[model samples]
Target: MIKELVAGVVATTWKRLHGPAQWRILWLKHATFMIGVTGVVLDDHDRVLLLKHRFWKDCPWGTPSGYIERGETIEAGFAREVAEETGLTVGQVAIHKINSGFRLRMEVSVIGRLIGAAEPQVDGVEVTEARFFRRDELPDGLRASQREVILAAGATS
Candidate 1:
């Protein structure tokens, strides 16, 4: 009986000593790999495409953004998100900007040109509406970060 009690105490001490490492192992198993991509579409008139997101109650006016799906490259993910949100096919993608905040996760912004004269069609659940607006004509409800991206795209357009 004493041997059994001593064994229990040793086991408890060991668990307390390595508890953090075990917890880290468990956290890594459940950690989500967060990634996001944004497409900056510009019209010939220097107007930028903006999507009104239905899910975002705090900031509705945002860009066409979505997560990078499993087994997809960043560029391909951006193209897929653009096509899924707005039915326009992207011709070419150019890395416009990159924002990294916390945990080595990144939000990649790419400038995509619409193929031919195809218009944008909002078809995704997240994207409720889509429209092109000039820099000065940006809607008042746009998020501050989105406004910054639109102005940056305007400068390069």
Candidate 2:
């Protein structure tokens, strides 16, 4: 009985130390501040993709963005954001710029070319519309931050 208790404690302790919880603990330890990521996706016509979120109707149209997942690389998370929000696959993600402010979350803007799935598939839940807009003729209600990211990325390309 004593041996069994020791083994069980060891097993549970191992699981807690090496499981998903460990990742979160490590992430928290390493993260001095939270980080966010957004992708500037361009289609064949050089237009940028923007999403209209249903929940944030009052906010302007924004690019596909989300927090980086535990154990996921920033590029992978960026691509995942594009796919989740617009149902579009991205190729060759490259860092455009890093937006940082004192005491504010840092955002990484990545640029990528759309590889497949030209038409966007919005679920009508979170994302209501996903469409490509020309740089000079972007739709109204585009968030200023997103607009700046797009313009800055466009300038470097």
Candidate 3:
């Protein structure tokens, strides 16, 4: 209790010294958490795109996903992750869900349509394979939560 009170006093004094604008910036830096993006990329046939990441152990086959780069909007980051991992462009991007990314990270899930005729070609290093699977016949090893997200995206269109 004494430590908490002392810390509170120090924070209040620091806030007053910095003024509101600087205090807000300092508070945001201390409070904001990491955000990541995942996508349920859909093709013309309504198949959902999935990738086999070389690094994942428990679940190697999953949706195209990555952390947001600095100055990137969630949509832009999602598109970049897809393209970087699978060599496929995505359009019609729309946020489908926002949920816990993992331990303490925040996730933004999006639904996007495949923009071109080119099929998915994995990066070969980070991602060993990329393929689109029919919604009715998704592959094994995909996280159940991701399967639900993909199904939910299919339900909308």
Candidate 4:
């Protein structure tokens, strides 16, 4: 029994020492300052660019999202995330909506038009596929919130 207790303690200590686990613990213990940005890119046909996430196997379809880097405005972060994920430079980004909740969250939806008819080159590790989909024909794998956002953006595009 004592041996088992010692092993458990060691395992707990090792997890605490790991980077991501430590960050999660600190975030839970103290108020976390988690900030994220999402980009909405519209094509000439009004189709919206969507990213299929590689990590979220349970919910594989998600928007192009990333945490805002230090000293980065939400707009800059949004633009950078879009370019990084889809290889498209966004121009004339406007904050269409904001969604904030319990985790110091900021969901800033910005609208931008695709500069050219180039295919998206998936560059981010989180993104497995990047494609444009009509609002009405969005893939069933997308999260409900993401589908809603795409539909709303399409209507206004």
Candidate 5:
């Protein structure tokens, strides 16, 4: 039901944007909608991987995440984000949930398995620190939504 509603809204908006010259201007003005992806990776010890983002000051520790690039599948994008942020290769990702933001941003969360026994490392730019933590030992300042996603992912796994 919710998916259909969202699809209908997007389709209607796209169709409405194809009208006259004034409406074309409206379309040009509304740019930069983003689809983001998050991965919940658990090690053999049931520890979850998290990255301390260098950019997000208030909420630093959260699931590895980034924007989905054009022409990239959501699972591929999630794998890319995890690798770029933590240097950990993803095995298989199972999508768990999707949440839309108040603005034009949408986030898809997934539970992913790591490929090998690689340790976490930072990219030194987007992510400053990467580490695995037990659920009770998760660090402070995680985003509320991301915390929920992590819990959901853990539950599914």
Candidate 6:
């Protein structure tokens, strides 16, 4: 009965809609998710990297993250964002967690290791500050979701 009612509603709604509405419903049925990759990158000492971005409303500290580019692998995008914002290279990465449901966008947290003994060198433009913080002593103004990602990554260490 519920299925029939739903089907009836869909049929009724479908008939009342025009071209754009049809496309919207079609998109709703076959929407592609936008993936934003977040890195829980850590150094050998298990310190988590944090960045203070300039364009943010309050310029809060957060992990290195960006939307995945077309045809770019998740790990590659993760490393790229870190390098672009912090000027630090990262090694291999593996998927750590997936957070979604706010909309069609998804946040993928990946675990990656810092490459060598090099320190971060931010450009002082897009990124104002970049450094690693001890797990127990993260700075103020960290986004709750990012803090949770950092803590969850720490738990797995």
lDDT leader: 3
lDDT by residue for model 4 over 34-68, one digit each (tens)?
Answer: 67677678887888888888888687777778888
lDDT string, candidate 3, 94-132, tens digits? 998899736668988889999989978876999999988
For candidate 5, write residues 1-157 as lDDT tens digits. Answer: 9999999998887776646855667768876678988878988876899888888878888888889998898999999888877788997788888887548888888888888999988768888888889899988888887788778867767
lDDT, candidate 1, 56-156, per-residue tens: 88878777888888788777888888888888777567777778764846787777766766778886577889988877787777766667776677677
Ranking by lDDT: 3, 6, 5, 2, 4, 1
Comparing candidate 5 with candidate 6, which one achieves the higher lDDT? Answer: 6
Model 4 RMSD in angstroms: 10.4
Worst 10 residues of 2 by lDDT: 26-35
> Residue 142, candidate 2: how far off, in angstroms?
2.1
Q: What is the C-alpha lDDT of each candidate?
A: 0.77, 0.82, 0.87, 0.77, 0.83, 0.86
**Which of 2 and 6 is the better model by TM-score?**
6
- Please tell me which model should have the higher lDDT, number 3 or number 6: 3
Q: Where is model 3 more than 4 Å wrong at Cα?
A: 1-20, 27-29, 101-103
The deviation in Å at residue 16 for candidate 5 is 19
lDDT of 6 by residue, 1-157 (tens): 9999999998998899999989877878886878998878899999999888888876468888888887898999899888888878998788888888857798898888899988999999888888889988988888777888888878877
Pairs that collide in candidate 1 are none
Count of backbone clashes, every candidate in sequence: 0, 1, 0, 0, 0, 0
Candidates 2 and 5 compared: the better one by lDDT is 5
10 residues in a row with least lDDT, candidate 6: 52-61
Please identify model 4 stretches exceeding 4 Å from their true place: 1-32
* Model 4 pairs whose backbones collide: none
